[model samples]
Target chain A: MPSLPPIRPEDVAVAEKTRPHGAFDPPSDAHDPVRAGYLMRLGDDALILGQRLSEWCGHAPSVEVDLSLANVALDLIGQATLLLNEAGDADTLAFKRDVLDFRNCWLVEQPNGDFARTMVRQLLFSTWQHMLYQRLTASRDEALAGIAAKAVKEVAYHRELAAEWVIRLGDGTEESTKRTLDGLAWCWRFVPELFEVDAEVEAAVSAGIAVDPRDFEAEYRAEITRALGEAGLPVPDDQRPILGGRRGHHSEHLGHLLAIMQYLPRTYPDAKW
Target chain B: MSDWPLWEVFVRSKGGLAHRHFGSVHAPDAEIALRHARDTYTRRMEGVSLWVVRSSDIVASDPDDAGQLFEPAADKVYRHPTFYEIPDEVKHI
Candidate 1:
């Protein structure tokens, strides 16, 4: 293990000046910029999805599903709490960051259109997240490794929740099958974006601080086909890859989501929960 | 959809303790019943194990049968442990 450099008080001052909690612009050249960006990417995925799933709190098709989705949302928020805490102050990282500053993958930011849509989205993201975190457990960065190790188990359960629902819906009544198939269609375009690598991610992988998610692209494809196939749903391949979230580019859906989710913190900047 | 059938949940908090009925949930099938059981009953890390059975599967005598069912035991004082001279050294007893 290479020794991390000694932390100077000036380093803290510089980091804060470059990137305060509510600042609109990300730091241009902060220390460990790639690592900080990677942590934000990880944090934003959980935060966005956690916000999306929370919308189902009172409106699920069934009470069981309501609790199930809420529990899944709770788990993602728990992950967000830890991951964002690592990058910066957890509350500020979540509540203060502007929508354009979030580095979540495009898939997680898609709207939860309906129950089928939400579950299918979860199935896709959680499966990838499980694979991503499993690989990250071996990262040379101790904080990333420790967070990934704990989160891997949580995502395994999330994958199960999503997979089971996909099977249940896809194999259920004619209406359910149609809805689930349509749901998959809604999210299919965003699938390939998960594997898109940028300079920062590339550097992190080279430095052993992160794993290249593209490396597991083949396995992810196979796992998806297996899980969805058993549920009698085919992997839809007609859609094109839609990329951008890692670079702070997002869909129109995210702005609407942020309007509702960020309203409180933005409105009452000084108030406590 | 209407509520799934109700399942009574029982949990074993620790070794050597009997599985005590905690609460219940509604699920369409046994597998989902177990999932719901875990989510609802064990979210607090309250138990080592879970059991979910259809609430209707449990047979219950009428509450009206209270006298005939359990009253006899009340008068059977000899069957009670009060008469035992429990020794201080008998740890668990």
Candidate 2:
């Protein structure tokens, strides 16, 4: 029943972005504040990853791949837009928020090192995302459930595409196999963070509006293992797990990414599309 | 290191409809070719079904030889469905 007020059209560019996080919070608000933050983080993960994938629009190795990547990016961006829309205007939430305020996983923010690396990242994320949305389709919150229903279908295709590529490159020639191995290794460290049950997520799960990401870990591991095995690769030895993306800490890459992503909005200020 | 074979794609928009050629995409093998077809051609829900055929396997008649191949059929009145007149009671025809 609780919803954030829509921003006035004139204030979208300035007042919304400049206002601090707590500035809009009402002390006696009825809903769980942490759950609201969880939704925002979920939206953030999609938005940031969407932005990362969009970087490959014209640069993928083949024209088919270029279109595939763009399609996937478009899907994630659509999810982000809707999820963010639940909180506030999607544009302000995406382009206006500072890096520290973003709540995406570090795995998504990593630069696309190569076609193999990008595919590996997609494989990892989509596999996890497919399961996440599948479970979230039953979320007690109807809005989240509806979004999950639509999102699971899209992520299913993304998972299939990425998994196939992982197998192709892993079973491919010497160079491609080497690249898949390296790409898998590069992405290995971020695996644990995808299921991190931080405070907001915990609260959301307790409220039944979110899935406890931990519940999907067993299947997540099995699916990734299966995809990697199909690719003829071994799982890397566990490294110290990276955390904190849920808490808004990110790698060096996201700031630079945002610098470009936010440039137009920051530069033009009130300029309308 | 070699590029995938070229495959022409066909899409059926609905049940009981004929598949029509949409476009071609290149993939390393048949399965990949089908996937590429799905990704490249059907992302918009444009098709209910898909078919992919290797460009090499299809023996397409040369367009330059069209007159020699089938041009004679164009003037064959007996081959036309409309060549026979139906009685007035045969309204559906």
Candidate 3:
């Protein structure tokens, strides 16, 4: 794969503000790409993970689980729409972007492994997202704050749903425990990427357009630690963190995901309901 | 998953409404069952409250005894309030 071009922080910071077309009026600075990028990063996280979760639509272990996963997927997609709309036209951003334009964390783009693995990923991502949204609800940016206010409640339930499964699978029978641990191992490496603060993020933070995730890294870890401990699982030792995705540098998996996600939109280009 | 117990779900759509039977879900415990019920039955703002009980706990009437249990009530038309004269002041009744 071609290496992604380095993100230009100035390009993000200097873009002029423009009004959105719809009923939703974002804050005056919403079109500044730095702020837009900030919002897109959050939206991309939701959009990608929402797509991944929807893969379980007809394939979950039970009918109830299928509905639950789909429900969460829909919630994430809804969040993505609102967040992306703040940045630009949501449909165009979602369907027209190339792999290198995506700003999601690498964690969300990782493929869903087994059921246990999916639950583990959900637990980790939702916990961070919940905290992030809670902080964003207080942001000086009205659009970010308003989006976060609505999203915090959704991520709270997402956190609860995943935590319950993590505890159950980790402390359940031997086979389940094994699968859950394997899931954790597969997912643990990606946690640090969620907290990474790069130049764009730094700009967004310094401008008070975004929260510094590093500020709450300890609390985030403690939250995960508590959940792991309850599941009778030991926290894995911190290792090298898998980074990139915020800057559009993603693993091979994201390319595959984008190919599928962008297919219909790219194919017809004008197909509409 | 088939080995998991079945739970019957009840949903109260609004305050002052009794919970009516909604559907069933399979879960290992009541807490999970309640979560499943929320996802399955209330996704469309269908309920303000939810109740989940183990399906096995409900003692249902036997279909074989249906005639003896309910047929006698069908013939009692006087049990209807139509025999009473309507008082205009009580128009709602």
Sort order, TM-score high to low: 3, 1, 2
Report the CAPRI category for model 3.
medium
Among all windows of ten consecutive residues in candidate 2 chain A, which has the lowest summed lDDT?
A23-32
Model 3 segments more than 4 A misplaced: A1-30, B82-93
* Fraction of native A-B contacts kept, per candidate: 0.47, 0.71, 1.00
User: Model 1, A92-192: lDDT tens per residue?
Assistant: 87877787888999899888888998999999999999999999999998878999999899899999989988999999889999999999999999998
Pick by DockQ: which candidate is best?
3
Identify the CAPRI category of the predicted complex in candidate 2.
acceptable
Best by lDDT: 3
CA lDDT of each prediction against the hidden true structure: 0.87, 0.86, 0.92
Which residue pairs collide in model 1, if any?
none
TM-score, per-candidate, Cα-based: 0.88, 0.87, 0.90
Q: After superposition, how far is residue A143 of candidate 3 from its true place, in Å?
A: 1.4
Error of 1 at A70 (Å): 1.2
- lDDT, model 3, position A25: 53
**DockQ, 0 to 1 scale, candidate 1:** 0.46
Distance from true location, Cα of A57 in model 3, Å? 1.2
Count clashes in each candidate, considering only residues at least 3 apart in sequence or on different chains: 0, 0, 0
